[model samples]
Every structure is written in C-alpha cells, then in structure tokens.
Target: MAVVDHAPGSGHRTAGDPGGPGPRGLGRIGAVPPRRRIDPADGLAAVTAWRTASDGSPPPRPVLATAVRWTLAELADRYPGGACEVRVPPFGVVQCIPGPRHTRGTPPNVVETDADTWLALATGRTTWADAVATGRVSASGERADLSGLLPLE
Candidate 1:
C-alpha cells in the first residue's frame, strides 16, 4: 500500500526515526503544528456554502479532497527522483530529480511525511530539515536530502 501522511484522526509520529538518516542533516526550519480532526461532512458543508455565496455557483464535488490529491500529484512530479519518492493518498509515486534510476524494491532514498507537513513544505511554510528534526518527517539514503528542492511554492 502507498504510504499516507494523514489517516483520519490518528496522529502521526512526532519524532524522526533514528534507525534512518541523521537529524536535520539539511538545516533547521520550523515545526508544523499538529492538526485536529475535522469532520469531513462539516468541512464539505462549509466549503460548499462559502463557494455558493462567494461565486453564486454550486460547490464543486469534494473539492477539498480533489485539491489535496492534485497537490500531491503536482509535488510528486515536480520533485521527481529515482532515489526518493513522495507518497500521499489519491496520488501515487512520482519520479523526481533526474538521477540514476532504481527499478528494484526499496529506493535508495525516500522521504515520507504527512499530508499537512508536505503541504506546508510545498507552500514554503516549512523546511524539510526542520520537519525531519522534529520527527515530523522520516527520510533515508544519501541523496535523500531534499532541503534544496522543496516548498515548490
């Protein structure tokens, strides 16, 4: 199964795993605030009402989820690397960073974090090293240092 950063109400790991790469090998940025559970229905309703009043048009179907999926896909494609891969639900793996290709089981490098954290990093709100140091991200491999190619913003 594809790795997912967010899973309903289950909180993610807050500390980076030691068995993998070292902490903040890149540089310190900031930590992402933990997210609270949001009722899908309630969120959908709020978005729908806001859209209708704001644009006088019907709300898009599951627009939030769709947007998240799109965001994941865009990032995955933007940072393609044969050694590493970004995982988010609804959007699959994307080859980023042109390099020696890997066609085996485990990739040489990999960085996995939650959807919120990923979004924050993508939007220039967070840093890869900071997230990894705070245990918000789990990364491995030599070239897995994604500090340079982040916050696609």
Candidate 2:
C-alpha cells in the first residue's frame, strides 16, 4: 500500500490508490456504493464533470487532487512559458515562459500531445527531453525549447 502524508490539521485518511477501498471513490470496483438504489451513471457523471469542469476549484480532500495539483504545478513550472502558455486539448491549456506572443497562424513555438502523455510528463513519470528525444512528443521552434523545464512533478 502507498503511504500518504496527512495535512497539518486534517484527520488521516486513505482513498483508494492504496490497496483498499477509498472513502469517496468506487470501492473495490464491484462493491455497492454506501448509498442505496443510486444509478451508476450518476456517479460516473459526477466524476466526469469534476474532471472536465473549468471552475478551477480543487477537488475534495482525501481525493486525487494532490496528484492532479502536483501534476499541474509541475507542468506549470517545467513549461518555460509558465502556466498561461501551454495548451492541451481536453483537460487543460496553459501558457508558460515569457516570449513574443503570437496571435495568428501557428505560434513559432508549440507543443501538442495527448492528456495521458501530458499527465505522465507532469507527474515525473516521463521527461520532456526524453519524450521529445524519443519522438513520443512533438516540439517546434527556438523559444519552444522546453528542455529547461519539463516532467513537472
């Protein structure tokens, strides 16, 4: 089981991702939800909405927000243009670094990849230089050189 540290004042808890049922997640995959007679779709919709929403609100504690935030912060720091520059397709698009901004056509620097790959890079599971070197990620332009910052977490 993975060990997680507790917040300074909160009670200790573990939510899945550790070897047992998580408090708010789908427990054990097949075990019934704590509440009775609820449609499965509702739960799925909630999680999906939470994942896609743009409110910038953090997910509830004892949830996956730690990993998510870690991923975002890592990406934010690693990407040269900062958090406002990079752009992802479905999950997020942020910009990083300080460079001449482009308004039309392709910006001289651009990096595009799928969500999973981006998440992986953000979480330190992959490296920007390695991903680009391996041809798994596409990078273009001089200012677009992200070797200085990458693999967020």
Per-residue lDDT over 46-125 for candidate 1, one digit per residue giving the tens place of the 0 to 100 score: 44443354346533445544434555555556765565666644433454567887776887777777655665676567
Q: What is the lDDT of residue 114 in candidate 2?
A: 58
Over 14-131, each residue of candidate 2 has an lDDT whose tens digit, in order, gives 4644443475555565555552222335433434444554247744532333333334444554554531345455444545677676655657777776555655565456788877
Residue 97 CA error for candidate 1 (Å)?
1.0
Clashing pairs in 1: 5-114, 15-135, 16-135, 79-96, 80-95, 80-96, 80-97, 81-96
Candidate 2 ranges beyond 4 A from true positions: 1-85
Q: Global lDDT for candidate 1?
A: 0.58
Please give each candidate's TM-score.
0.52, 0.45
- Note the Cα lDDT for every prediction shown: 0.58, 0.53
